[model samples]
Target chain A: MSGVAVRAGLFEQTDAGVTLLGDRCRTCDAHQFPRAGICTLCGAPDPVPVQLAATGTLWAWTWVTAPPPGYDGPVPYGFGVVELPEGLRVITRLVLDPDVAPTVGQPMRAVLDTVGTDPESGHDLVSWAFSPLDASVGL
Target chain B: MTTSEVVVAGVGIHPFGRFGDRTATDLGVVAARAALAEAGVTAREQIGITFCGTAYGGVASGHRVMSALARSGGPIVDVEAGCASGAAALMLAASAIRSGQHETVLVLGLEKMPAGVIRSSFFAPWQEQAGLTPAPAYFALRAQRLMATAQLTTRDLATVVVKNRANGVANPDAMFRTAVTVDEVLASRLICPPLHLFMLCSPNAGAAAVVLRRARPDDAGAGSVRLRAAALRSHLPGDVLGEATPLSGLAVDDIPAASTLAATAAYEEAGLGPDDLDLVECQDTDAARELLAYEELGLCGPGECGRLLRDGTTAPNGALPVNVSGGLLSKGEPLGASALGQVVELVRQLRGEAGARQVDGARVALAHTVGRGANASVTILTR
Candidate 1:
């Protein structure tokens, strides 16, 4: 379950679980994923980094049948918006059961998994993704 | 500065479709020349400035087009706002004319998009690798939400394609001329759940241009189309899931979308409402987006778009005929040329030149486009 992260500064894997790295505004309490130096809502500089909630509700979902440019992942993979408890809706890759269609309001939990392979380095690319909480043990 | 009424002196377009050998400058020059000819503007000094709208066109795209025409002395600025690029340029041109800064200004929109599904550089390399780019998946995700909350069904989505493609049959400039049935559209390949192949628009090459000038007293009697109102707005903060932000937004925030903001401002500026519009050309990047536009533009109430379509209110012969020029769904979205192309179609219809797709007694029209960066533009024109 260990590999090179697709990108740095996005998420961290600990013995406890996978948590996304984000920033929270000290002034207005706004949250941003992939962590920003300044708060977009209040324009407050130097927002502090924080770990986002591990679980969220599915806001929307879809299956990408065709691969986008530079995407070396499996075709027809699940993708969706997950609204975390902190009020941030994060767009992420979805790990789903083949026969189950995703529905709004379903509970999803974050996981670090292989999303694709880097075309240049030929290494398995790992990134933060979400999976149905009740469906399976792991992606 | 004394403000003046601005009029669309002329409009021209290069047909929308795939053009393998043609460059963006070539497409832009042809449209610009036609617009100049139609406006009776022969001398280069007659044009005070030039604005070009393009997303894919490279550096100095406007300069390149103007140089090609040998009319390069004036200020040639290029504008980009994703799919709203043309509308943004037109907004600037109209403002210049209204402020009396220039007697005449030329606006050109052109694009030579790369083949296959659009690969915008808007996303970071990691985002592209993660498959979060604004492509079919993002569109499908939005459509999925609409279906859940707006009473939109997969069948309703098919009906939009059916209506627009049928309308495209009448527009020679449209990329898709053949009418498709709901059955055929539904039977097409499913790019995503709830969205079929026909539901999406093709990104291709095309160009459209407009000539704006301060209206003279004689123009009142000449059936000239006046630029009644032109408004552009960007996405407000806190809708993490809204089109504005690429990755995040506050889920509970209730800010209005860019389309609503732009439409509201345009309606106020023109002293008109949705009831005043006789026809409309809205962005139909996907079938569901057109329906979403219905609510966003105030044509119908929220969660009421499905009923409006089922009741045939947006049809060719309906009370408010929309996309009579086939929209991006049929004409194919060249990004930069899209909104200006809609303007060209509206001008033709107002002049009684839209032979097959004419809405009877059409007098007022609106063109709406929204795209990446969450930019939205709404333009109202009157005969």
Candidate 2:
């Protein structure tokens, strides 16, 4: 079953798994996530859109117990910077149990999960997260 | 480099606490008047220009503050640089004095934050929608990494809270003047893992002001404290770990953080090293942040903060006294007013007027602040 992504142009679902999306500068080979109108590295006005790696390593992680405004996720959730093999880091949720902790340098794979159900539309608001490659995934 | 000297003649502050009924103008005008009164400078005649720093005061904040005091007809500029708004204003005023452009300028930092967790809009819409936008989450991420790499623990972090809370006891201007224990700090509700609720600063209301002037040769008996240097810097290109940076950070590590760059420039401008500092009032938005600041401000070697806190090196009477005003941890963060509050404390300490919180024989002091928009500022004062 397909659900609406929390934000467009961030990731795409495929048979293999979910892959993060970004833009790559052809002139300087710089990569930016969520794409950019202008390349931050080479000053190019337009860059090529590309899919990011499905697997990465957890660089740093934190558990946010207090939710900020505009958030609809569960309380006391985990999120962190996941370093892709191509040397780019993206901030995304670490989809794990509330009690489980993520270790730095641990392998993680992008996955699609339902963040919450829209109150008005009654549709699942899907979001991307990083799940541990070695452990059983739960959300 | 013989730079022209700019001195802080006087400072005034509206006690940092929740003022639900007061507006930013009321606090700003009161503090401005007190500073001008203490400086023996009339607002309309002696002051040449005014700079008001505020993040949420809206437009014409300077004009509103001036009009409230029945003083005007001079240029008053409003500035906003997140939490470092006051430091940015101080730097501009000092530069004007150093350039010989203006002799006397009044700088005011004021804020009246909305009650609740600060709903910062620094992150993208997607990040905020996904619950990745809380301020403590970022602090905790850094704390976790620093603990892993620097050999720090939750206990070490708790010690910083304990020290700052105890320091608050002597500061009447602080919102939390009661001392707390390490156990209480560690046992407090965790806003984020490794960061307790008590370890974080609330978004509160307050105001602080300083009067700066070019010193004269015959001003020997004056209450002026020399503004040795006021330096402001922004984050280098690849500062991924910075609070203001985008969620997707560059994986590069060669670029320095804004605080380090600002501190280096301040030391060079002041011609004084960290060893010469009698006391410091660096940013302590959280307990772990104070440890990060120790390294960024060149107070200690990297990875040595754990040992430093355990040995009481930064206590009130330790080798280096930091945050004698209880820091934002106890004062709560008033955003625009936070850095100026640090300046007020430093001025009091350098002038030997800090009472029970005084660092013995403190003749030189430093005030540092780092804020969103990747801004960092360091101001050094000497007596």
Candidate 3:
């Protein structure tokens, strides 16, 4: 199945896999997600677009039962901070079942999946999330 | 004068709860009028400036409030700094008085939030789309981390709720006056993992107002309370792993949070330390966040909050007696009025007017708040 990203410039999906897009400052060696025009760490005026590691480790996780406004996803979903090998962390929905309890320091690999569907257009709203590398945890 | 002494001449509040028919303007007017009357200034013309803090009240909120009171003669400013809006506004009013820019200033905080979960727009659109926008999600995440590091359990979190609710029973102005047991808190529906429904505050409606003036000669002998320090701080770069952060967070550790920075500045400016505080009213948006605040405000050592809770070090009769007003947990957070509501409680404690919840011989008190924008404010008041 094919679907578009929920937001632009966050990540790209291709035949190979999904790679998170980010900005790295050449002058200061700063890293940020969502491609910043300037380096947030060093105030450098120039930043180069860089692809982040697709796999990371789950540092912390939570089950969000109460949804926010405009949320069109299943209730009681799991979301957490995934720490990439590069050291920066990105908050993403953990591709896990609501009843599944995630442990800290678990290996996680980013996967492009459907977060919700636009009711009018009937198009799946896809975003990147981290799934347990272990098949048992993924279930 | 580089350090002019500022005093809180008066304070007022419209009870925090669902006032379905009343608008933010009405609440603000009522509180402002009571504050003005308490200051012995019957005429609003005596107020040289006014600052109104609100998150939802739209443009010219201060102007609308001033016009309602027929006090539109002076400069009126509307300030928004997330949940610290009221404290920020009070800080501004105190600064104007300290700088000799105005003799008398009125600070008002008003809010009328929508029912149910508070949907904040502070996160990026993508983050929101990923279902990370509900306020409690971040709180639960933080709580989970704290539980790991501080060796706290769900029972400890529930105990915090029970303590605060018990304190709330004595506060006439608090929204939830009924107390809850630990079992009840634990049984409450889970909004976010590690955070039960009763453990978190509701986004409700209310308003708080205070009148500030330069300390006069007679203030020395009177019962008036002086504002020793009103300090505000914003989030620093690389400190993004906590509440209200967007998609990305820094890898670095040991970066001080906004609350610590604000508290340090406030303590320095007030010539006091955590040990000197007679009582406190830190933001208890959730049960665990209050534990984090104990460390951030220098009330206890890091990772020592669990012990503090077990020993009742922050209970009404404990060493610190934090949030004796029942806090946002009991008051149902009206973002704008939240911080100033803390001040009103501090005033009551200091003046010995807090009938049942009063801490014995309270002289120095601190009110702390933190919210979106990573804004943190700590206001120290002394009698």
Q: Pick the candidate with the highest lDDT.
A: 1
lDDT of 3 at B22: 90
- Candidate 2: CAPRI quality band: medium
Off by over 4 Å in 1: A118-122, A137-139, B1-3
CA shift of B285, model 3, Å? 0.8
Writing each residue's lDDT as its tens digit, candidate 1 over B1-383 gives: 12388889999899999988999888998899999999999898999989899999989999998888856478989999999999999999988877778999999999998767888777788887777774888888878878877888899999999999999998999999999999999999999777899999999999999999998878886478888888999988877656675577787735788999999999998889999999999989999999999999999988899988899999998999899998888999999999999999999999888998989899999999998788899999989
Which is better, 1 or 3, measured by DockQ?
1
Model 3, B194-280: lDDT tens digits are 899999988899999999998887788548799999999987776555544767777776779999999999999999999999999
User: For each candidate, what is chain B's TM-score?
Assistant: 0.97, 0.96, 0.97
Give the fraction of reference interface contacts each candidate recovers. 0.76, 0.70, 0.71
Ranking by DockQ: 1, 3, 2
Compute the lDDT for candidate 1: 0.88
Residues A1-139 of candidate 1: C-alpha lDDT, one tens digit per residue: 7567878999988776788999999999889887888998789999999999898999988888888997877777788889999989898888887688778898999986677887777778888889988877454
Which pairs, if any, clash in model 3? none
TM-scores of the candidates, chain A only: 0.92, 0.91, 0.89
Q: Between candidates 1 and 2, which one is better according to DockQ?
A: 1
